[model samples]
Target: MLFKFRRHWETPWEVVDSKAVKPVYMYYDDEDSLDIVAVSDADTRGTYVFEVNHLTRTALRNAVTFSRQQLIHQVAKKGFNVLVLESWRLTIFRRGKSHRVEVMYSGRPAEALGKLPHLPPPPFMDVLHEFM
Candidate 1:
């Protein structure tokens, strides 16, 4: 824990809400670069913040996909395939006309020992090359 640039599922904030529920940052690696040794689940604090309560103006991307599909079905029944540091948040309350919707989903659960290598693409994507 000496250095980190940000890769807790890498989500700064960008939910246009066309049916929001977008979070599953593929595979994470902020310089960890595919070392493959993940077995993180330190005594059950692996991280998870599920909260989906709806009833606002109706239609909230299906309550954020029913709270991210019940947090990926309880993290794949606790066996975990891969779910690194994902993040999500969206809250609203009015009360004047009965409005209250929340969709908070966090993540951090891993058990990857195989098949997870495919993440090299960041370095600004080579400045998005396009010289034509």
Candidate 2:
């Protein structure tokens, strides 16, 4: 899916390929900013931090239809710790202090992560069951 970024002091929007890297932490601030820290290179533990303005923030907010804390709570209710969105799949991870396990939901490449717009609908029990 396409992710748009409006950087601070920049009027034009910057488009990015969300699937290029796996995002580990994502937050939307009250100042109309969206902060995302992704694992750019797992081998080096490198990260890419993107701080974008209101437009991008609104796009993401509309996509998820929920607040950051709500999303985390929803995922926690299912016993998952991390959520990764790829071009072709949604991968949910269960992490421990040292190790992590994952479960993937395939198809729906166009759908944004956290926004499960498929049949048999929301509260994604099928996907959540994988975590258990």
Candidate 3:
């Protein structure tokens, strides 16, 4: 039946509830420093906005993990555009108290590693489809 077929092919984007999910962020600064902050209700719940340092191996790995989790939740393992995935980034505030927003997801593991200068891609990409 058409209903069954549609259900079979549907890709579920699992968006976390703003109230229940506690989003977290790990930022890297230029001096090999890592700063992590959890996104609370006072801040944007599901959005990451800041200029965290992306130039460390661990930082890059963490960023990939963060994005992968969200993407898996959103796309439900139906597969994603590699090009699109490689183009995503997590943006954040720089040197001001201002809370302006931006996106820095490059979807590419290589790009993330580049920021660190010496690192491999996160390990989670290997099992991205298992959850779907």
Candidate 1, residues 1-132, lDDT tens digits: the string is 798787776544332231122344546567354444555553222222223244433244455446555765677687865556555555544433344455666566666665566533212222112201
TM-score of model 1 (CA atoms) = 0.27
TM-scores, all models, native as reference: 0.27, 0.18, 0.26
Candidate order by TM-score, decreasing, is 1, 3, 2
Model 3 Cα lDDT, one tens digit per residue, 66-121:
75556434432333211212233333333332232233333321112223233234
Better of 1 and 2 by lDDT: 1
Q: Candidates ranked by lDDT, best first?
A: 1, 3, 2
Each model's lDDT: 0.47, 0.28, 0.33
Worst 10 residues of 1 by lDDT: 123-132
Point to the candidate with the largest TM-score: 1
Query: Best candidate, lDDT-wise?
Result: 1
RMSD of each: 17.3, 20.1, 18.2
The better candidate by lDDT, 1 or 3, is 1
lDDT of 1: 0.47
After superposing candidate 2, which stretches have Cα over 4 Å from the reference?
1-66, 86-132
